[model samples]
Target chain A: MLALIRSEWLKIRRSVIWLLLLVSPGLAGLIGLFGVREEQPGGPFPWLIALALMTALHAMLFLPLLTGVYAALVCRYEHAGGGWKQLLSLPVTRTRVYIVKFLFVMGLVALTQLLFLAVLLLIGTAKGGGGAIPWSELLGSVGRGWLACLPLAALQLAVSTAWSSFAAPLAVNVVFTIPNMLVANSADYAPYYPWVQPLLAMMPHQNGYDFGAFTLPSLTLLSVVMGSFVVFFLGGWAYFARKAV
Target chain B: MSLRILSAELLKIRRKFIWFLIFLGPIGVVGLQAVNFGLRYDYLVGKVYRDDLWGGLIENVTILMVPTLFIGLAILASMVAGIEHQTNSWKQTLALPVTRTQVFTGKFLLNLLLLLVSTTLVAAGTIVLGIVLGFGTGIPYGVLLKACYYPFLAIVPFIALQNWLSVTFQNQAFPLTVGIAGMVVSMFSIRFGDWFPWKWPYLINAAKEPLYSVACGLAFGLVVLAAGLAHFVRKDVK
Candidate 1:
């Protein structure tokens, strides 16, 4: 499995998709900085809104698409130049190959999230001028946001693998972008929908951070992650195993 | 030969990414807005951002800037037929009896249809959002319809550009990347407002009147579309 993953990683690196993936998050973060209103010489412009705006802007442009693109690229490698058939010709089981690819995509997602967090921290600290870093708040937001993306990442991977086209996964991402935004703002049933959890966890308040409104209970995150993992893995496995290649 | 070629072209489109956007994009937008309305009602209610808060809110929520939705469509449309060149599918497609004109038309029509469907979804999402936002009293149906029409008109140039890019580039990423980059640039450019016609998909919702004279934009769209078709018909797919 490790060898399979390593080979997949090598293929991704060779394809240049990995480099594209690494650069997009930072580019998106820089774009967010462009929209940031420099704190009016006196003080911050409502810290919560500023933070929320910063987080939401980056999340809106980069996070979901980044995850979708990463997932698609990983799955796309197998489809490129008939890489899947050649890989399957090896002694490894189909299930192991699927698992390894999925893990790799998820790992890439975590890395991007960390990159986003790092960018946010660097910007926030620099702008805040030696002020106490809101470490707990930032981590909380990052944790929740990253956790919320699991289901989406799973869905994107399933779609990309099943369709075997970059456009298909991209279309799926485009289609969901608005709906996900609206769903994230809903109060009644947002807790039930896994997609909204990340945005909900990042909501702002009057002072420092409104952790109360945005925090996702561990149980909910656990349930969502477990449910998505099972569904996504089984779905990918079933489609890849049964489909005529 | 023409029928076989056209059928093959259609099949490629069916397999393209644009289908997913056509089917699901607007539905997601509307559903998300409904949720946003439910949660942020307090903040939204009785709020006025200048004299046209209601209109402003409607525009902000309905605009394509929600998250790369419009740009994604533009990129997909621009690259749909072009991918054939990248994957060597065009060589196979051109080998059939069909003339280049037929193949180009088929792909253009398909791209147009996808764009239309996405626009319709955005329109529907906007209506649903208006109701959900508890501004049923404030939103004028005419304004919403007008706003929706603007995306269609504005997208004409984008569709044209996509067709042009696809034919010019053999690699699929070339067209897609260019289209995406164009959209990001437009976001900054349109902020100036005077360059609206060249903005290629005017941000109607954000405009003061939300409707403008799109004659120049329409002319540009037609010119580009005609030029793209002519180029495809004259150029060899190889």
Candidate 2:
């Protein structure tokens, strides 16, 4: 498992995915910085405002789509030229390999989340936010948003493993994810929908938006997040282990 | 020359999931509105008055569909290029009697055709969705036509750019990332002026004349297409 994880990390490090991951957050932060400035020059809850602006783009669409792309990139080399057979032929267990790849994708997503957090903080400070930094809100929203991406990574990995044409899983991801903006607003469906979890988790507190009203209670939110993580991770593992290379 | 290659390009996409994808773009966009209106029929309908309801429905669908169309076009371009990339047939196809320009033109036309089809589907689906929601069947023909098409015209530069990126990069993720970032920036650009290519799609319905955007899309799209094809012709295929 350790060896597989190391190899997976090596493969990703050599790719442009890391650099590309920064592009979305970097753009969001720039926009958010300008947004904070324009909204009354450090007005009420500037950190929350900056976060709202950041999450509005990042959590809603970029992160979900990026999750799919990262999973596909991690699996890209493996999906080519009997690469899976080559990897599985090693003494390493397929289950461990699958888990490790999934872990790497989650780790990449976490790095993106942390980068986004840094950008959010930087934007807040640069804009001279009026209030003391909302540490709990920042961490809770960013951290939970990252956590919400685990199930997506797992599901994307499963699809990536099954499809060799790199864009197939990605298109599928985009098709499913683009509706997050709408579905995340649904009072009845947002709580249970895995696709909308990141949006819900990343939403700023009392933002007076439709999404603000749609957030699940903490207990329900935790259950949904953890529950999806288990189901997708295990289901992906089972399919990968038995899938014909 | 162009027609033969166009048919060939279309044929290539058939064995792949490109058709399903072309259809998926509109279905996804219209389907979201279906659910949105289905759930909040009274609230949404109440928000808009009688005759204007049709325009409101088209407008609401257009707002959401812009991002969908942007992202969807990026995916379609990649998928079109990926068909050739996946098979390692680029060199083989290019080495044929057909010129690279013809091949590029065919691929570009195919992408345009797919976008047109998706746009048509969105227009049709919006009409269908509006009727089902009982928003009165008077269908604002002009608004509906513009809503369906203006974005497609406005998106030509982006389509050209994405096609270029996808065709050039063996790894599809780069173009996909660029497109996603474009979508993010485009969201913010709406507040800015209409100078940016990403902003063109939404700007078609701006308060000013819509032709300003349409003109930009045409001029810029051709320039980008020519530049991309030039590079594609010169670039060595592995």
RMSD of each: 5.8, 2.1
lDDT of 2 at B190: 71
Instruction: Kindly list the per-residue Cα lDDT of model 1 for residues B1-238, writing each as its tens digit.
Output: 5456546656776655456656565665555555555555566555534455457655765554423444565556644754674375777877767777777767766677666777777776776666655555666767666666665776677677777776665434445544444554455554445456545455443444434435555777788888988887777656
Model 1, DockQ value? 0.26
Off by over 4 Å in 2: A38-45, A129-131, A207-215, B204-207
| lDDT at position B96, candidate 2 | 85
Chain B TM-score of candidate number 1 = 0.78
For each candidate, what is the lDDT? 0.62, 0.84
Which tens-of-lDDT digit does each residue in A1-245 have in candidate 2? 77887788777776888688798689888778666545564355467767887888888888998999999998988876778999999999987888888788888898898899888877777666535888998999889998889888988998999999888899878877877777776677778888878888888766565443354587887788889888988888898878988
- TM-score of predicted chain B versus true chain B for each candidate: 0.78, 0.95
All candidates' TM-scores? 0.72, 0.95
Alpha carbon lDDT at A145, candidate 2:
91
Consecutive 10-residue window with the lowest summed lDDT within model 2 chain A: A36-45
